[model samples]
Target: MRFFRAAYAVAWKDVLLELRRKETFTAMFFFSLLVLLMFNFTLNLDRTQVLSLAPGLLWLAITFTGVLGLGKGFLAERENECMDGLILSPVPRGAIFLG
Candidate 1:
């Protein structure tokens, strides 16, 4: 229960910070669109080409956007030194890394 609460609190904190800043989602969305466009332009996304490359394109977009989102996800904690606070909370280091 305590672990669950902590997880929920951390998630809620992230959501609230994102709501206030609004830049993370905006940047991620724009970057994803750019990636999609690049895939189309460079790969020549015709039906046959798209069929073959579609999985790669989709996964590439997801991976890139996930990386973007990951960087942005830490924005609030970095700004407010929340990472230090989290570390002091007794959670295992591996859990923090996974988080």
Candidate 2:
């Protein structure tokens, strides 16, 4: 329960920060859109070929966007020195990891 609580707190903090800034959200949105558009334009596949490849392309877009978003979040924390505070907190290391 304590671990969950700490994780929740950290998640909530991140949510609030994201809501305020929207930096990660905006970047991920644009990047994913650009990727999709680029794929659509560059692929000369027929309908059947496109259908077969759609799922893989979708996952690729999602994976890249997720990487970008997470990278931005970590960079923000590092820039603000919040990671040090998190490390110094009384929460267990596992809880912090979960967070």
Candidate 3:
């Protein structure tokens, strides 16, 4: 219960921060859009080929965006010393990992 509470708290904090800033969301949106545009121009694929490739391209964009967002979030936390505070908190290691 305690672990879950800590994880929830961390997650809520991150959600609130993200809602206020929106930097990650905006970057990911543009990056995914650019990737789709690039594929459209570079592939010159017919409709059938595009349909087949769409799933792969979508997953690629999602995976990369998640990586980029996580990296940026962690970097920002580190820069602000929030990561250190989390580390020093009494929360269990697993809870921190979940967070």
Candidate 4:
């Protein structure tokens, strides 16, 4: 219970910071949109084919965007020295990850 509480606290802090800046959300949105657009232009699929492929394409964009977003989030924390602060805290590594 304590472990979960700490994890929630950490996650909440991360969420609040993200809400304040909105960079991660915007970047992820644009990146995913760009990816989908690239595919749409390149594939030239008929409407039926595009409909069929929608799920796969969406997942592909989501996968790449998620990877980039995680890296960007880590970089933000590192640049602001927050990563070191988190490291010095008593929080378990898993809790930090959950954040």
lDDT, candidates in the order shown: 0.79, 0.90, 0.85, 0.89
Question: Which TM-score value belongs to model 2?
Answer: 0.91
* Runs of candidate 4 exceeding 4 Å displacement: none
Alpha-carbon deviation at 78 in model 2, angstroms: 0.7
What's each prediction's TM-score?
A: 0.78, 0.91, 0.89, 0.86
Tens digit of per-residue lDDT, candidate 4, span 11-79? 898778778878789999999999999999999999999999999999999999999887887788889
- Candidate 2: residue 30 lDDT (0-100): 97
| Best model number under lDDT | 2
Candidate 1 has what TM-score? Answer: 0.78
| Candidate 1: tens digits of C-alpha lDDT, residues 34-66 | 999888888755798788888888899989998
> Cα RMSD (Å) between model 2 and the true structure?
1.2
lDDT of 2 by residue, 1-99 (tens): 999999989989988888888767888899999998899999989999999999999999999999998888888999999989999999988887777
| Candidate 3 local lDDT, 1-99, one digit each (tens) | 999999989988888877887878899789888877887898888999999999998888788778888888888788899978988989987888897
Better of 1 and 3 by TM-score: 3
Residue-level lDDT for 70 in candidate 2: 84
What is the alpha-carbon lDDT for the whole of candidate 1?
A: 0.79
